[model samples]
Target: MENHNPPQLGNQLCFPLYVIAKEITGLYRPFLDELDITYPQYLVMMVLWEKDGLTVNQIGEKLYLDSGTLTPLLKRLEAKGILIRKRKKEDERVVEIFLQQSGKDLQQKACQIPAKMQEKLNLSSEDLLELKETVQKILNKIQK
Candidate 1:
């Protein structure tokens, strides 16, 4: 005899992940809107905040984004005066992103976002760390 269990939304792993990602992004929207940056743009800024003067390709690699997607987001941030993309003097073909004064200032304001988001999430520190570690383990396995 053959099993007759049909696939359903409840049985799919992607469904919960999709919903969680959407909800998390939604939770960030108000805070992001205050800074006038979308979630993907925010990810780029966070990377730059940690290490400034990275090339476009470096940022793309870190964020797992393609040039087509990153280019427009970078343009928007550049237009906002948050960053400047300059051609490297030694190799003009290479463009490096440097944070502007505005971008640095924005970092100070953005620092509070994590704590606020945590408060919104309302999970214990222990629980949060465990979840993060578990997700990271899964992500590492997937990446490899």
Candidate 2:
């Protein structure tokens, strides 16, 4: 007779990673709610704040989202007057996203979020940097 070992959730790396991700996002929920945006929407806003007039495909690439998922999110932001999308005049097939006055204004308020989150997490700068570096290393390996 052959003996078999059963899989255990406690032994799986994914289990803890999933829990940590959920908890971290939960920590951001209240802050994001005050900004009237979800985490994913906030990511899009951050990308635009860094550089405006990026194409739909460009935003999708940065966010790791597909057009199907990104379209509705962009539509909601457009309806909220946070941004506007326009097709390129020369290449009608390409669409670009631009931030509005409201979106630019939102950045001023969002500037405080990093400090607030750091306070909430109660982690020292060194600890936070270590965690970020570890996660980036894992992500880099996974991407390959």
Highest lDDT, which number? 2
Tens-digit lDDT track for model 2 on 72-95?
A: 999999999999999999999999
Question: Among all windows of ten consecutive residues in candidate 2, which has the lowest summed lDDT?
Answer: 1-10
- Report the C-alpha lDDT of model 1 over 5-44, residue by residue, as the tens digit: 9989998988998998899999999998999899998999
Could you tell me the C-alpha RMSD of candidate 1 in Å? 1.7
Cα shift from native, residue 126, model 2 (Å): 0.9
Off by over 4 Å in 1: 1-4
Per-candidate TM-scores read 0.94, 0.94
Q: Which stretches of candidate 2 lie over 4 Å from their true place?
A: 1-3
Model 1 residue 94 distance off true place after TM-score fit, in angstroms: 1.4
What C-alpha lDDT values do all the predictions have?
Answer: 0.93, 0.95
lDDT of 1: 0.93
**Which residue pairs show collisions in model 1?**
none
